[model samples]
Target: MSPVSETHLAHRLNLRLNVEPSEIGGIRHTVIQHIGSWECAAIADDVILVVSELLANVHEHAEGVCELEIEHQDEGLVVKVSDTFMTPPTLGHRHGSAETGRGLLLVDALTDHWETTITGTGKVITCTFGTPGRGISP
Candidate 1:
């Protein structure tokens, strides 16, 4: 069978919110709403989850404000989460008694691709998930 054609668009949404602990869910919802009309709902959800984790981390550890920018691509959505915290995120080992270090770990598990870039202001964690047609069948 031929490769399926996928709907695609590239745009960016900026989320500005207080780094207060309670704002993480709002950030996630913002992302979901922004991506709702895309044909890649599954990928959108994955990106939303990753974005949530990163934002939560900022709320728990960072200061002042946190921002998120999502770029929708043909194959997937690219998510970037930035905060004032200069320290890199810790992907704590869950094998032990650690109950609270799995944010980035979850991002790793959910996204098909991800990476972190240290910016002049802070670090931006980028993650991506493939849309339906981009899936490769074995």
Candidate 2:
């Protein structure tokens, strides 16, 4: 099935998929392609990591399908991942030796700003990354 939907115009892509570990790679590639086409390739690595972390969280914590919305703005790119779980994710405090619980930490380190908003059905985690000299904190 086509995970991408043409709901938004240029510079925006919306994907709704069943959250699964096997699908994460395909989703990451889709985001990378869109980032390249949007002329935001400079931040592609960070974006890919952020998307992977977010999708992993959904697959592990949430139930069923999730919606991934990516939009490229003048400053940078915005990624919003909405899942059917109402519980908001916390910034995990994993020890250096721990193997799990570093997803949110990676997101926090990569994104300029990120937040979770609760909807009637679920929660949406929005991550923003800004380009150089675009008001992103150092």
Candidate 3:
């Protein structure tokens, strides 16, 4: 028998999380469990942080539920976190010794490709991280 190809193995998982103020930890653990199943390398670890930041942002500012969608492509995993916040995310040093304000910056540092798109109702932050041995630098 032959091993399954990476392309055949990477699976896509999508999640919608409420922007509750206190569920960030639970959300992060859920994402880790879901994505960690994949044989992808450090990509899972990188994604865990990204999801935490994204969800934290949503809980802090967004007014409605936050949606998190993850698609595992042949080359890597694509994560999209959408919220109904009107203000755009600015990547810079956090205001001060604040515990927050640095989520987006962290995402930028971890992911290979990332972008933000504004929609009629809100905004969607998308990031992609490459898998370990599949020719990516996760």
* Winning model by TM-score: 2
Q: Could you tell me every candidate's TM-score relative to the true structure? A: 0.79, 0.91, 0.79
Using lDDT, rank the candidates from best to worst.
2, 3, 1
Structure candidate 2, residue pairs in collision: none
Q: Over the stretch 1-138, how does candidate 3's per-residue lDDT look in tens digits?
A: 011111223476666666564666666665676676765656777888888777767767885377778877778888888888867888888667887677777898999878889999889888988876553343
Best by lDDT: 2
lDDT against true structure, model 1: 0.67
lDDT against true structure, model 3: 0.73
| Cα deviation of 25, candidate 2, in Å | 1.2
Q: How many clashing residue pairs appear in each of the predictions shown?
A: 0, 0, 0
lDDT of 1 by residue, 1-138 (tens): 011121223466766666555656665665677688665676776777777777677767776366667776676677777776778776656766677776777888997777777889888776777777684121
| Of 2 and 3, the candidate ranking higher by lDDT | 2
| Candidate models: Cα lDDT each | 0.67, 0.84, 0.73
Stronger candidate by TM-score (1 vs 2): 2
> What's the residue-level lDDT of 50 in candidate 2?
91
lDDT at residue 108 of model 3 (Cα atoms): 88
> Over the stretch 33-119, how does candidate 2's per-residue lDDT look in tens digits?
788889887889999999888888787888647899998888898889998899998886988999898888889999999999999
